[model samples]
Target: MVTGKMFDMTTPAALLADDTAYAEAVETAVKAAAAYYATGESALDDEAYDRLARAITAYEAEHPERVLPGSPSGKVAGGAAQGDVPHTVAMLSLDNVFSPEEFTTWAASVERRIGRPVAGWSVEPKLDGLAVAARYVDGRLARLITRGDGRAGEDVSHAIGTIVGLPEKLGEPATLEVRGEVLMTTDQFERANTVRTAHGGAPFVNPRNGAAGSLRAKDRPYTVEMTFFCYGALPLPDTAAELADALGESTHSEVLDRVAGLGVHTAADTAVPPRTASGAAEVLERVAEIAGLRAELPFGIDGVVIKADSAADQRDAGSGTRAPRWAIAFKLPAVEKVTTLVSVEWNVGRTGIIAPRAVLEPVRIDGSTVTYATLHNPADITGRDLRIGDHVMVYKAGDVIPRVEAPVAHLRTGAEQPIVFPEVCPQCGSEIDTSEQRWRCVRGRDCRVVASISYAVGRDQLDIEGLGTTRVVQLVDAGLAGDVADLFTLTREQLLSLDRMGETSTDNLLAAIDAAKRQPLARVLAALGVRGTGRSMSRRIARHFATMDRLRAADAAAIEQVEGIGTGKAPVIVEELAELAPLIDKLTVAGVNMTEPGATPPPAEGEEPAPSDAGGPLAGQTVVVTGAMTGSLEKLSRNQVNELVERAGGKSSSSVSKRTALVVAGEKAGSKRAKAEELGIPLMTPAEFAALVADFLDEE
Candidate 1:
């Protein structure tokens, strides 16, 4: 359903010409739909399933005679499921549009069909859950039914007490049918898995699947609660004919309001609520707003549902077999997908930490093709029972790296192979240090000389202008440099002898290396690639200790005195610093600055240091910078902004939390910005952030 073009895709037309390929695609789609609708478990993820369905539809349009009877198009639950219980009215799925252009075209068609422009539009999230109808008799809940095959549904009245937000008895005694979605909240999903596993049940694959299983499940040892969000309501039975007629005539938003009054929870209860928009542009704006909030929502929403608010207009537009002409779902990108774990590659980092990365069969997720996902470590793979050829659920949120959530154990075909842990260092073929969960090369940084040296000269570290990975590799291979310290000792003639090294280039490289020697202790420390220290942590340490001599002299307890360094991490930092003592001595001899500028040392010995100034603008505050810097802050990287935040007397955090004082949101800010807005955290633009830290910027 994603509007963005998928990667590694075979043309739909190409597949249509081959009967074997067409049948295979159809069979795959049909099976996936059957499993998805019946048990809420499917081998194919939403994205893959939707792609197949779309292709089948396109093929059917071109070659009607070749259309298969089991095709998933224009059918509720892909016609894979059915129930005998008849519905008072059909429970239908909405048609989808992937972009504003498609949505505008759909709106135009609807207006043209109705012989007038729509009065208004109501927009709300299209909850990614199973649709169901709850019928209440005299305001007392009587039956719960799944939207099986649209015309009829299965009786799931047994799940009556397990659903939240759907009152057993209405505020007023009135017979009505509330149409809505049944889904588990994010917290509920996690708790459900914990409880299920505790009771010897296999954990549910995802929130949507868990909700579906929970809804129809009977005779289980434990109950996992699901929430019901009312999307529509209609009158049912003979006792509420008048109310039914009124509901039939009422606008969609008005219907939601009426249902809320009857003790049914609706989107109106949350930060993101349904709203009425006057035109297509407003509707699109609301759609974008909902999409922006998707990552922060407590539950999943695959798209935004936009419908004509006028009941009269709805009647004029009429309906199709699958969806109403008056409504359309604006689909967003798929955040999760099921893919095969083809292999696992262990790569050595600059610190010699060997990390396992899962090589997956290319799958499109969140508008990008992902073939590799972070695997944490061999222990994580073993703990999750991940195996080669396993069907793994891949999760990607915003710009965060894709990661394997877990393997879909139930979908395995027994061709899976156990993921073997490396016995030796994969990169340098040396003995591996397996004492820690993350295996490392016994040779440490020496095993990755080029990477270590490249990181040292990076822009956020020593900031040597002419040095890059290619140049670092060249120097390492040519025997001119073996480590970061060697960069400062390089002769001008040696640099000039390298390929493409002109006289101007050689001088620029030399000058850059010379300039790098004067960088503050914080930058120098960051360049050293300490196991637990990045730019921010290095800055904090330098600011706390003021000089390398003081930092090297501090023990774990003394290091813990600095903010954000925990007791457990303090000892690791101490050990890493001890190991790097030789390298530190080498850099010191090379004349790199040994103290951070503008920093005052801690009070001598055991005396308590003077308290920080409470009047400083960002004092005692935690700030997070996200997206891209702009205006005067454009030239600064995220690390530089963090440095500026610290210099301005604030603690910089990468994650947004309840304790976060503010968020500096910039261009294209995604989840963090949404989270800040959701949590009511104050937000400052890059310009505002620049203004707030003007003094620190001037110092830089």
Candidate 2:
């Protein structure tokens, strides 16, 4: 930990920057943080972090290129990370409140300012993601900006190019401004975790971290590389219900709808401020009740924000020079528990990676049990220096994955044993390679575990139906099958013998497995669990070599020749094929259809289709036009292009997907157009896409 001498509140300390001023700075920061998190405020989110962060920044600015070792600015909000944006709106953090007394005190503070109990306010969920702004002019999206330092930010304007849901334009008329949060979906986070593990990057603590990291990643090519969502808008409408009612059911929803619409994501139910803090507290309780549901929501939120509804009253109320006076946020406490790490267990994965999981004495957190949090892999144990019998502090970090925050080394017994990792694959007995994040068994195709089984039964693999997770677990637990070869060898009678296995279900499963045998060699290769090969990669290999034996006969040189299969991946391919070859021959001899039928098919006789299966100007084109798009020429208006193209049987692509055709250039198209060019995709002026979609443009 970076530590510095405690600053003296008033005078000089040679060891410190300025002892007296530094102490005052520290006090101010702590006070600001205390104000932020104690209650979740609709006024501003992440208040505690914001308050201290601002204090640190002020001191840093005074002494350029200098930061206090222990200053809050040096760390992320939760004291977990240390990466900073160059100079976004100094991201002033919010203060929090937990108890009704604290909430009441904050409310009284607001009341004191307003000189009366303020009436009519809006309370919104404090979505735990990067906050951004959408500026629309003449009913069209002009620019999408991030809340960098609350004032200035890097022109991530390119996000408009790829982030879904945020439209290139607004749904209503006249210039409109909207502010919302960008968040990640659970599926996306899980996928990122898998990828990050593979990439040797730090695991993102939560969706908020995921969003913040991705959005600020200068190297990231697209915003969707981190999923984004827009919730809550400014420019309050006449009535609370009217504005809330219009969000989903109006043109405004449509204009900014592309971000969420493309993904089919839903927003949290918004509500106006309850008549009283008790009522507001009750709504917050519901938010807390589903805290475990952080995984289910398409977006992430930390707590509920309650705001006074009356815009006029809100103006009359004013703010604290730091946060809005009309709003207070009620946040659920972080799910932290003091649990004994009774023991540690090492489990091997499909690839023979040994992952250590902690077996904790049971406790409740976020409404779930307190046992068995993943240690990630053998390496994590050493990095964290965790051992069995440590009285550890475990918290459901970010309300998703449970992790050991820290160990109470003070409680460690002198007799604790250091954890050890296995040197061989438990399933196949292959030698393991101890690495930083994983213990890999180099046996390649031979090891049998979760990743392998999932790959084998994947949609592009054996295509087995009725052989879902339950059946797989049953088969594995029964000890009758140790490998994929055993799966094809199972008889209906053997399957029927398992508990809960009905005759009809057994018959259907057998049929499904039988049907899967006829699938092509690419799928066979995919099912064999090649480390770096996926369905898409497998397809590239198949396109290069049709039959399994044919591909197997080829060496590493030939495998590397495939479009997607790089030389680095070739050895894994060859190793996998070598291990699975005998099994394939056995299955083939077992009457499984191992190859595609018939003689080599004739080549296509016509010109190849456009890169996109459908070819029109817009077919292989992407356009993001901001500002007023005037006149018809197959030209999509900023207001209507999103729906028009999609409705016209064309898909509007996000900033980063392979499906993006061309990003249409427009005035201040922001980050989307630049990102399109960076991605090496074509860029087109409105006229270019216009001439293509003549039918729609000619309507006028």
Candidate 3:
């Protein structure tokens, strides 16, 4: 058994100044780490071990010649196994960026090293799972190795059959090595815990811990479902872009596609192509999008990986002693915290769905003071055995809403009371419908009209500038509005009667309400708050039908024809539409547009349009706009550039691929400009783009 202090408490700077002290610290950290991984126990927590490792790394950096031979700085952390299998290539750890500024700084450093701006980048979700390297010989599974210590790892070939998304053989015969993450999904983690509990075993903490335990377990019933998502490969290509090209693929995005085709699972809709000359801004946006989607994903993601998309650029940037210089992990802020569960509150939504919320002692998480967290539903409460007065683990779902993950059962002193679901509506004291796990109020619109109206004016929907929750409540309480459509009917006198309303406020609110009528049909659909439809689904529906009249006339079968709308949702859509007909008619009578804006109509018969430049000024042609712009376009955002391209009847592309027809080079344009010149694609200045747009608008 390991005993005494696991790590030496030495400051990184101080340790770096002394070679002998740093070497001893590294030795202690490595031995302790190995013992912990091999025995499933540790004297030092992850943070302590990480600090020691970091010190070693800092010391090695300052005195590269004096670096110890068997230094832990050169090895993967927590990679200690009973037996070793040599890795074909070292499994390196990534350098991390916790904020947008850091990520931007890292990108700037890369550009400085490459002596040119990066044209494109690949952004992918960073999976919080165990790392594994799978080797295939003659297209058959030859070996599976853990990321034990960079050079060597534990052989887990015996557990290959039990792993999901990892095929024993490829479709074609080829010698390849695939490196990826092994993890258990949230569902699988829960199921495993359930089985373990039934057999009188303690539950696993989280999916990451559960995956590690299941993979290392050498026993019968090796059927604990695990999943693999491939991120890298060997023969060790300089970059993902190089790997793609070597495999006859066009871009890094195509590399992931090919990996998926080879029977490995990769996160869907998570790969974002780089836009803009610097690539930093586009990557940061992608990171934000991924963070927003974290809670909704089946598996867990702690951050996003951003990499330079050009093979030559990556080669020029090269690698550090451990991490690649071309790539960085942009991590989301920590969302988990232990907080006291003061009580449970049942909150009512616009749809009359009554959900349980945990009223907590105020705790700060991810820079926000979270006092209440979502309990999901009554079933979730019971399944997790959450109770009042219990110490609970609170985490932000998708880095957005705070949610109760689980209770710290060991902290319970038998004084905790089981949280009971409300039998009556909190708003109206009406009988609650508990037929499903999610309790709802039978009162429906009568009790939820305020919420419905508030949602209608929300930013994602109508975006009424002056219509806020307070005004919405006042309108509802005064009986001036009963539903969302009733807001349009509200008179100036009624608005003036509200506590805070004046002539200016009343006129602004009315004008905002009037402007909402001209919003796209998709926005109108989203404002209606259909049971299963969101902004994206509503957009799909609007694009499909083109007009509100067509959407209203669409039956269940017709609605189901749209992608993402399955058979189960189709009938619901039909039923909801029928129920909302009266409200739809009211909005139509209020002079709503009833049509999606910017939708392209079908071509006229006997008219053949020219092949290039099809849509607007840039129509039928793929155009790439890069760098900062001058003149009127100077102040426009990067997104505005793409918008201008699309508005000019041209397709806006992020990368200058072979498919590109035109390159709009702005002020200080970089590698993309060079690439455009090399590829013989027509290059235009920002002034030219502005002139082209002006010409198109003039013609219109």
Per-model lDDT: 0.86, 0.55, 0.72
Q: Where does candidate 1 have its weakest 10-residue lDDT segment?
A: 2-11
lDDT of 2 by residue, 254-311 (tens): 4234334323222522221122223444434433333323333355555656666555
Residue 641 lDDT, candidate 3, scale 0-100: 63
| Candidate achieving higher TM-score, 1 or 3 | 1
Q: State the lDDT of candidate 1 residue by residue for 1-700, as single tens digits.
A: 2232421132232345666677788898889999999877899887667777877777788778887787888987888878889999898888877767778889999999999999999999899889999999988999999999999999999999889998888999988899999999989987897787778676677788899888888999889999999999887766566788879999999999989998999998675688899988888766766776676678988888999998999999999898899999877778889989999999999999999999999998876799999999876676567889988888775567988877888888898999888888989899999888888999999999998998889999999998888888899999999889999999989998899999999999999999999999999889998887778888889988989999999999999988888988899889999999999998999988899876778898688977654245798899999989999999988888888888788889998878899999999887678768767899999999889888889876
Q: Where is model 3 more than 4 Å wrong at Cα? A: 1-127, 132-139, 142-155, 164-167, 170-181, 184-205, 217-344, 358-374, 383-417, 458-466, 491-520, 546-550, 585-700
The candidate that wins on lDDT is 1
TM-score for candidate 2, residues paired by index: 0.43
TM-scores for all predictions? 0.77, 0.43, 0.59
Sort the predicted structures by lDDT, highest score first: 1, 3, 2
- Separately for all candidates shown, the number of backbone clashes (residues 3 or more apart, or on different chains) is 0, 62, 12
Quote model 3's TM-score: 0.59
Model 1 alpha-carbon miss at residue 535, Å: 3.3
